[model samples]
Target chain A: MTSAPELVAIVPAGGAGTRLWPLSRRSRPKFLLDLLGTGRTLLQDTADRLAPLTGPDGLLVVTGTAHAAAVADQLPQLAGDGAANLLTEPSPRDSMAAIGLAAAVVEHRHGPTVVGSFAADHVVPEPGGFHDAVRTAVEAARAGYVTTIGIAATGPSTAFGYVRRGAPLEGVPGAYAVASFVEKPDEDTARGYLATGEYSWNAGMFVARTDVLLGHLTRHQPTLEAGLREIAAAWDTPAREEVLARVWPGLTKIAIDHAIAEPVAAEGGVAVVPGAFSWDDVGDWDALGGLLPADEAGAHTLAAATSAGDNGAARPTTAGPLLAIDSPDAVIASDGGAVAVLGLPGVVVVRTGDAVLVVHRDHAQRVKAVVDALAAGGRPDLL
Target chain B: MTSAPELVAIVPAGGAGTRLWPLSRRSRPKFLLDLLGTGRTLLQDTADRLAPLTGPDGLLVVTGTAHAAAVADQLPQLAGDGAANLLTEPSPRDSMAAIGLAAAVVEHRHGPTVVGSFAADHVVPEPGGFHDAVRTAVEAARAGYVTTIGIAATGPSTAFGYVRRGAPLEGVPGAYAVASFVEKPDEDTARGYLATGEYSWNAGMFVARTDVLLGHLTRHQPTLEAGLREIAAAWDTPAREEVLARVWPGLTKIAIDHAIAEPVAAEGGVAVVPGAFSWDDVGDWDALGGLLPADEAGAHTLAAATSAGDNGAARPTTAGPLLAIDSPDAVIASDGGAVAVLGLPGVVVVRTGDAVLVVHRDHAQRVKAVVDALAAGGRPDLL
Candidate 1:
């Protein structure tokens, strides 16, 4: 078929920024946030970072029903032609179903090409090095192997999953066959993993030939394979959407790492390419600050209207009407109402139209607590 | 004139909650605030506190032009017969002008009756004790003494002025003649003042014969006395509003403590009643927690709908939505935007709609630094 397309990119931009609340809500997810006002959203920035690697040819985006319009609106440059493929999920199944959905679509359209799955909410400052790492993973993927990119461990951060590097691949020097996959480890384990040079962060960036991914899924997860077949067979049929709606809700709520990569590594043939660029999930408010320019006090306000001088009057000096303030070391994002961080440190304050949230930054992972609370309170309207 | 009316209560209620920021705005000064949600405002409570002392008809309110309507709206009981005797300042001239103008009006109408000058913003919890103290001061005032009630110093609080208790007056047993008035002392001097039994807080609650206050002002500050006479002459005349408009703007912006109390004390003859009652200016957000019913965690909030349930998901399980979340030892307040506190001890976070202020609670007196910064930036609107 004229030598299947050289490179394929699949971006899943569907994470709700519960941690980044107030500034990010169900209507506005983290990927669409114009954090730092760099004139580009995290999704656009992710798309831009992968642009050179795919060579202006092939890129695809799969997002949830809520975020599809926003994804399409933000990256207008990828419009007109079929250069960007935007797909929508039928329901809120986890990343496994999302990846499966995108992989099936990519395989149907692009055939046996190499596919790179990237999260839309990440930032890789060094574009050229990231592009090179993706190229290396693509090279490994072409050699009949499923490849994943592992970021070099920066610190003993207990917040992310870890990948253990195995035997070196034949053609790629930096590429290693993944020894194993580990879930987010405890602090001591993370420190241990960091001390050993064999471990790197499981950045969720993966590259695999379309056929290889399908084969891995069929062998390891028969239910997912069956669902994919059912979805593909009824593709142009009226039952397509309904079948997905039926099947997706039943699929296991698991990450691609747990469903596919760990199982593949258990069989001992997966390869890993160490990423060359600086990468962060932009996971919390602290992560957002690392990307911004700060003053001598180490305070970084997301409310751009607030700077040193405005902190005194507790008013915004900027014309945008500062809706938030002097919450040193806290991340405050406001949409309708103003939020001020008085003497608050290491906290997240969010002010939406009807709901306002104040939480400790470290406990942000538990913001699902608020979501659960909202649901139990029978206020799905808030969610 | 039938021995004159016994007393005229000068209720000073002119301050905007500027230092308290967002919550305490131009429209909602500290006096108008429902701080403890007793359903009575600070001003109404102040008026109610004085009601028993001054038999049904001895109250007058002096407030700014913007807040006159709110003052009248809240204190309707005090204005049962007349127009509330609500005197409006064309603009904020300072406490000296407000007090002087009130003194002039009281003198003209009530002749030489004892004038009990009470702050609309202070909270005296023990009404019985406060009335007894007022009675003692009125007795002193009728004897031609400018009687000031001095609070027993609780701690080394640099936020308030200090009064050194001198020898006792001949007839006033529990009262002491004034030695001198000290400006807000430094921390060291405040500690020294707290250590000695001879010093007390300049509670700003004074009882004086109308003629005694006017005479003291006329002797110590002739310019301000002239301005007061001009403002008084304008009353009940066609040229009254016009002359007050011309004269008040040019009057020296000074606190009565500095322009009159200090000089009067230096000249001797002022008497101090050892007043016993819980008192607070309810100065900032940090101060609100003490005024209101704190939650189990000693947290206070000002939201329309608040439910602190352990089982609620939308709200925090451990800590709730705090307008200003001052930590274990920190103090923070806001007008109503989102405010948070983290990792800070003994700090004060204040969020004004116009500005955000963060300072240690002990250093709250330095809020002027924020005001100064706003002024330096040419932002008079915030100031």
Candidate 2:
């Protein structure tokens, strides 16, 4: 068979991740942090995972202007030739503008090639399965369908949306038409969806030909599509700044799922490839703790520049060691100094230079409420 | 009737307070910390309460040499007259040496004054009742009894010892003969003691004339009494350090209760003054939380140099405010930066410059185990 069409990976690197605060802040968000004590940050790991599928030079990163420098610093391999693959938005316009702009730029510069969008802050262990799924999704995308990689449901998790799958596509193996996309469900509904054995967790991974994605956007959201196209036309020229300054602000601020996937799926256009890789958004401290290996006491500690050995014991490479007593299931992180948790099980304690956060694992999601309260109290320095 | 025999307060300010770890360290113990957020440390508050009863020059503080400078810095008013009243020990020799040495020195300087030994870390709110109790104890001491102030039992607490009271003393009103002094008992014994109406919480507050106290020591442990007297002879001379180096190390390493109070009470030479005041040893974070009035959310925040008003709302005078959400009855203290607690009811969070401690109120006493573990792990910087 002839070589498959080249695919470019577009990463939308954003989100403050307030639910993981004290470790994740506005100035230093989750994507740029070595949150799991791995030597590489989440963004670097994402790039590492996608580089094999997209080739060495075929990756584009779209991020907010504030984080563009950090994103480039984190992924030096993507920073070649004036770092042309690094795209910066003046302000956040959600996933639609971020991904659409990258697709339009790829189409303008390299013709209509297949492209996949991945978040910069998700964790995927065991990348072989991910590679297989993305390859199948790219194959389906080349067949003129907007394809998405739906993660295998590890549990009946109410934290993630579900994607219902239809019959397998005629040509693409391991790929099926999308029946529907459901929002985050209640526990019972999620259990029902899991029991049906026809649904996968929506991990927000989408792949399509650049022309196919842009054409769908042009039909569904003409103003946003036109703005991205106009910016792309002048991207390589001196007129890029002028076009972006004028068109970027008025672009519709909508998510890609709403702008394209749902509407397109209703018309029998979307396809999904089942991804059998372990994945998590690391949405909160509890979620991050789930990805880490527990110590002998069944506690998890996340430190910078450390890793767990094959036997699941931490080999800490830095100071500020976590000392816990009678505190099982504790998730303790400190960039400041030693943190000692005594008799508080399932507790989350995080300490940075300027702030400290203590919460129960069950209340990890409510940490965003703390961020909101800080914002309301005019303590943006902490946020 | 005899002007209360000129009472002198002796504060044996020792104990590393490992249960209050991270805030109370070996070098900087709990007595020197402003744990109640009253703009004064427990040592200073103790001095403030006793200075009124003992007069400006009548209160003597005995602490370790490592904390002498910090103690002097906290209570500058006690540093007058060549700083003679601020006694510094060469090393810890337990309560007998600490209190007996101070009593001997008082007798050497002031000649047979009634000396009351109060812990420098205890908290006595509504000191009117405490003052009245001390006055009555002083009268009993003048009547040749080793008198102790017994706190009204608030609950069946197994954390403190119980003092059983006997028939009222013949002449000293509100002072009763001590039936016995019992060690910290099991839960059932403590509950039985509380139900008898004849037992009071042993607060470790003992008062007696310096001559009477030294006489009891001489009868019980003559070698300890002689060593203390030898040190007292050179206290005001250049020979003080020389004598301390020669004798202090060999002094009996015993508690005053075992050496004097228990035996003297068995002989009916000990008296009990019922103290109907709100008193706490401030033994752990839980005890401190009980003393401080809670805010509207039923949480307590203690900061350096800040005070809670009569209504119990904190009037913080600096930055780094303590913020909490859905955390009730939480005790948070910070000398570092802002601390936020979410959804952890009855949690105690303490942050110092080099260490942070998180524990539940129910397990506050177990913090000493954390300190022991840290010490075992060669983390002396944390201790």
Where is model 2 more than 4 Å wrong at Cα?
Answer: A1-5, A305-317, B1-5, B305-319
Best by DockQ: 2
Q: Isolated chain A: TM-score per model?
A: 0.84, 0.94
RMSD (CA, Å), candidate 2 to true, equals 4.2
Please compute DockQ, using alpha carbons, for every candidate against the native two-chain complex. 0.23, 0.78
lDDT of 1 by residue, B3-39 (tens): 3457778888866566665445555667776555555
Tens digit per residue, CA lDDT, model 2, B154-180: 888888888999999999999999999
Q: What is the TM-score of each candidate against the true structure?
A: 0.86, 0.94
* Residue A62, model 1: Cα distance from true site in angstroms: 2.1
Q: Give the per-residue lDDT digits (tens) of candidate 1, residues A1-383.
A: 23445787888788767666545667877787766656567787888888877756567788878777666677655554442367677776777777777777667655777888999988887788788888889989988778999998889988889999889999887788988999899989999988888899998988998788888888888888778767755654678778877776677677788788888988875899987688888886667766765544345545432111211111232331222224456655444333434444565555444445555666566566566555565655555
lDDT of 2 by residue, A1-383 (tens): 12323889999999988999977888878887778877777888888899889888888999998888777777766677788889999999999999999999888888888999999999998899999999999999999999999988888898998999998998999999999999999999999999999999998899999999999998999999999999999997899999999999999999999999999999999999988888889999999888888988788997653222332233345546687788899998887588999888899999877778999999998999989988998889889
The best candidate in terms of TM-score = 2
